[model samples]
Target chain A: MEENEMRRVDLVVIGGSAGSFTVLLEILPKIRTDIDFAIVVVLHRKNNFTTSIADVFDQKCALPVLECEDKDRIEKGKIYFAPADYHLLIEKDSCFSLDYSEKVNFSRPAIDITFKNAADVYQSKLVGILLSGANADGAEGLAYIKQKSGTTIVQDPESAEIATMPNEALKLCKPDFIANVGEIADLINQF
Target chain B: MRIYTLVDDDDLETLLNDVANKYGYDFTEYSKASMKRRVNRLCTLDKFASFAELRYRVLNNDSYFARFVEEVTVNVTEMFRDQHFYKTLRDEIIPQLGVHSHIKIWLAGCSTGEEAYSLSILLHEANLAHKAIIYATDINPRVLETARNGIYPIHLIRGYSQNYINSGGITDFSDYYTANYDYARFVDKLREHMIFATHNLVSDSSFNEFQLILCRNVLIYFDKNLQDKVFNLFDASLENLGYLALGSKETIKFSHLERRYQQIGKEKIWRKMK
Candidate 1:
């Protein structure tokens, strides 16, 4: 085998909305805490609601889960969730940049914004995963990630709580992997 | 297949220094991550091949420099954002400030002056409008001008009205503004008690003392050291036992000033005890 066939993963961005939280609960238990990549999560939330997804996920996941704050440094082995009403963007320096611009696809913490920014910052070392949602927010972003040569994954639309988001992502670009919640965890761990 | 080479962190730092040196605005203390993302965005949007080219344009062009500043600062604000915060301000903080014969309130980093206008409305409800003068300041001159205009897209007014009702607004929210064709202009009376000014929090020193200061969400963009510096500034600028309100996510728990302030209620409002 050629030496560089396996590229190191720097960041794993999981974008979803609606029913993605249930999928997260399914995957978080299986994700190896020792994995060498940072995981940033972007799930849509109501405009002014308080966010507690990190705390909710913390109960099931071994790794620390946090609601991202502006300027929070990205570190491997920890999970970060996009705060409500802010678009979570990845900086070139590998940290979080929160913005309050107008909502996209009717979601403030738009999955597309996070995925596109992560693609720009992490480039080929990134892995973008699109999961269940009611809207098509992450579709263009997943395509952008694929264009940057990053690995892109989509949850099998049949297994999605809401197929619209995953189906839209598949329509926009051919992801490198298509798996259900359990298989997606194994695919991530294989990295 | 194209390779995307990320901008080097050191080179970005150098470019920031160049901008500061030429523009006379210090951005060094701002969080590196957000700054890098914004600069990279500007690079793509402006079609600059490199940060070096960006530095040259920013140094030579005045209008581009203004655009650069706008891109760097965060401008996402809404009327009566964090509705409960406004509710608490009306129920608790305003009553406390009423004890003073005249109130001077400072809204730091008042982007587009939504918070400032929101405060003006609350003051009107509390019968404190006549006695209160709000100094709404931001670093971006463009946003300050927008704040002065007090005009917003009519489409957004519905959500703002809901926020107003949520914040215990007693009167018809529509009474505050006149909606025409595509925009809603806030009543001129609401603009009277407010003064919009350009104030740079990073490099500028405090010039006036206030009975209450609200610096919400703005500090989250700053580094820990810079946050401490601003907290010190707030501490100095606030009158004895004056109130301070931070964004919901922000806290003074770890700051040096934490012990000096006491949390008032469920709200982010705090009273300086010492």
Candidate 2:
């Protein structure tokens, strides 16, 4: 693979837990609404919280955001959020599957499970981003995407409200890029 | 615009049909994407060199095919899962159902009997246990046997207990189960009111009519067509105005039978108003 060659992508998957809402608020609304790739976000929250996070994201982002349902078709230029209490997975057909299988990383919508499945489906034609979180959930998943030759990015730890997630991913994958909130917004907009 | 095919969909479809013809167990209506993933996983787990070898083993060996059936079905469930549904069952559905002198509830795809046992606990608390007869059925006989035993790992009980408390449980969660070593055995009294049976949602017809039916998380594995077939089966089995509970993520909104049912308290629990 050439160093300067741009990787073609059909989807962008971003994972965060704990302190990620603020980072998303900063980055999502700024991304160019016309970008071609689909975006999926997995954020961990309390089990009892009934508020729709996708509705919140929809308010802040230029792109339409939705809570993923089982067997939902994945389309270009849309954003999908893992519904609470379900593990959002991507199938070979490129549709979504919400699994009630036991929690991984003590989270139902675990980042690892989603990222690994995304890597299997997208291979090199995907971009995985790990943002601010308190747990080590997304580290191994980000590494998986990197091993599959997909682009991987970690929020520069200094900019992450909680640095554990980004730092752990950085340690595991030594990802393709490290950028803060604003630069990540720019990087994604370029696609 | 190109889709990768590690195993071609048509070949897998043929393999599934062979298993059905040989064993009388059907897999035709299941969602292909997830089913393909599950089949691929079975191949890797059993170290089968190819799908053709898997097909041969499934045709020639009965025990191997049984193992294949277990691997393909999804058995993810917990006692009082989706606390809100259980809470609604206690606060609204059960109270209205109390008017009936004898109640029959069918729990379709009742994997491992957690949901069945959860319902029994609710009935016992509501003082309706004597009148309630719950039928807990699943496609996997192995899980139905475990469901009949009513024993769960002690570690998992803590989570169930928390869910129980969250669902407005009035008694101590430990009162329902006796813990010994690493396993918790639910009381025999709760088990007495329930009957566990083996019924495949894909191939089997409804065995009886019921006042309440629960088919949670099971239909998500099926394709849209299969889901509608199961929905028709549920509509046929459910007594008019009977309660139906689905998994939190499962929906009847897109099914042909959607107009026949009315959403109850939560979107997941519905009533067959028509």
Q: What share of the true interface contacts does each candidate keep?
A: 0.27, 0.32
Q: Which CAPRI tier for candidate 2?
A: acceptable
User: Could you say which candidate leads in TM-score?
Assistant: 2
The clash count of every prediction, one per candidate, is 0, 0
lDDT of candidate 2 over A1-191, digit per residue (tens): 23458678889999998789888888888878788889999999876777788888898887999999888889988999999888787877788877776677888789987887798789899899999999899998899888888899899999888999998887777888899888898888766
Residues B73-93 of candidate 1: C-alpha lDDT, one tens digit per residue: 788888998888998998989
TM-score of every model? 0.86, 0.88
Query: In model 2, which runs have C-alpha deviations exceeding 4 angstroms?
Result: A1-9, A75-77, A91-94, A105-107, A120-125, A132-150, A157-176, B1-14, B43-59
Model 1 agreement with the true structure over A33-139: per-residue lDDT tens digits: 89898888888766555647788888888999998876667999998888887778766667675666657788888888788778877889999999999999999
Give the least accurate 10-residue stretch of model 1 chain B, judged by summed lDDT: B1-10
Residue B140: error of model 1 in Å?
A: 1.3
Any runs in candidate 1 off by more than 4 Å, and if so which?
A1-11, A29-38, A48-51, A55-65, A71-78, A89-97, A104-106, A116-127, A134-136, A139-151, A161-164, A167-176, A189-191, B1-11, B47-53
